[model samples]
Target chain A: MNGPYVAVIGAGQATAEQERVAERVGELLAEAGAVLVSGGRGGVMLASCRGAHRRGGLTLGLLPGPDRAEGNPFLTVTVPTGMGELRNGLVARTADGVIAVGGGWGTLSEIGFAMRLGRPLIAVGSWTVEGPAREPSYPTADTAEAAVSWVLRQLG
Target chain B: MNGPYVAVIGAGQATAEQERVAERVGELLAEAGAVLVSGGRGGVMLASCRGAHRRGGLTLGLLPGPDRAEGNPFLTVTVPTGMGELRNGLVARTADGVIAVGGGWGTLSEIGFAMRLGRPLIAVGSWTVEGPAREPSYPTADTAEAAVSWVLRQLG
Candidate 1:
């Protein structure tokens, strides 16, 4: 994580499995000394940020609103987008690679952005993508550790 | 178009059918006195801008890069975002309604943003969007005329 930037794109209101995955991913990213970026909301975002902050990792949140106060408290930097869900593209652009946990429209959008930008992406669990291309567009992992490892390998 | 603003979100490089749809949507928006907005690159964006410009309608392009020169010549005003594809959210936020003429990662992101913001969206082609609450999220149309009409009707 020291030389690379990896973003964790996941559900804002995560499921139990997604929450666990995001937290572990955050902790791993922090341990690797990589900076973490997210949408700065609840659910997976909150969990990831909390994990990263606990591990003493730097975290940045791209908030949809105009106020930094709207960001999750775990974030070290708050980028006020005032662009709502559109900020997902920024998350993709900012990351050298990305780890997607669970699935949702927002996460899907981030995945699409990452693919379009030619950034590496690792998907955890089902993509929840409708009518996705049959062949895997990116790497898929079953656990947060595997996802983070794949992203790091891609970065390396 | 004079009274309202409509954004046409689609692929940067589109197929023949999509080009026709975008052009007609732009022309129809102009004829209905609604301003045309787009990402302002090529393919659908170019066709729509060309259509609106030919009809003496105002056209605005929200470009992702820093250079206004990268925008299509058809645009009346080229807004240089320097935010890469992140500018798609601005395209969605600026419009009163949006017409999605084709499918791509960029276009899908716009659709998600529009839906989250509760803005009216008319999908002119298949988007492969998942988990969109089947009822009252957005309308789907097969033709440019129908799409523009639906947006205008909603605006009215």
Candidate 2:
């Protein structure tokens, strides 16, 4: 059986805490037998791919730039989109669900696309998007374990 | 000399006023000898393509789904990305500049990508993004002519 394709979206320049969280999330996802998809660059993305790589999980990185070398070493498969920040949409689209760690404008863009496409999303120490009613649009998790659990459950 | 590649980003289902503005924007861009690009589905996208098509301007549509038939009839060329909403990043990446007519979440995602990529961007009665200092991030034009003029000027 094919594993679920889950994308981990976050900032390339992430905080130490965010990196730790993302790595744990990646490890958990990989252990669950999920195919990991990411933007395929550093910091949060790198950390997540590293975790998954060490666990012998399949990792796919959709690079924003055209050069494959820009992708992190941990990725098992890399596609250099050369589409710049636009590749974020592909990361969101290619995934069955999404887990966001620390994020910035680029990460926000992915979150927006994921929600717009009606994909299941979970955030761990990430940006919060409020709906018209000023309510949080998606569920949030306190830890990486919670996030992975929630996203996997939602996928199921 | 080749004309500039400007993307018209907006909602697939837009307000009538937005559609009118988008059509005029497309007409003005065509008159200026600029190539038009859009998501190429309906509402603002269709109106812009229609205006540009009538003026004999080249229009390219980057479709979200895999089917080319889903694109509007007015598009001169169409690429079905099968990337879903992720194709919004391609639309933003492929253009030299972007003009957003009133938008929804999907349009907002494109705007986010454009700004993140540092692509010259102008909003026409579209979403407003503020920087950390609470200042407007990009220029906004009141009219289609003004939008085309400002984006073209920014490009030059």
Which candidate number has the best TM-score? 1
lDDT of 2 by residue, A1-156 (tens): 299999999888887998999999889989999999999999999999999988989899999898999999999999999877777888888999999897777877887788788889988877654322232377889899999999999899
Give all TM-scores, in the order shown: 0.86, 0.79
lDDT of 2 by residue, B21-126 (tens): 9999899889888899999999899999998988989999999899999999999899999977878888888899999898777887887788777889988877
Give candidate 1 misplaced runs (Cα > 4 Å): A65-67, A79-86, A125-127, A130-136, B132-137
> What digit string (tens of lDDT, one per residue) describes model 1 on residues B118-145?
6788887746554422234467898998
Pairs clashing in candidate 1?
A: B1-B33, B1-B34, B2-B33
Query: What is the DockQ score, from 0 to 1, of model 1?
Result: 0.31
User: Of the candidates shown, which would achieve the greatest DockQ relative to the real structure?
Assistant: 1
For residue A81, give model 2's deviation from the true position in Å. Answer: 6.1
Relative to the real complex, the DockQ score for model 2 comes to: 0.27
Model 1: lDDT of residue A29: 93
Single out the weakest 10-residue window by summed lDDT for candidate 1 chain B: B128-137
- In model 2, state the lDDT of residue B6: 96
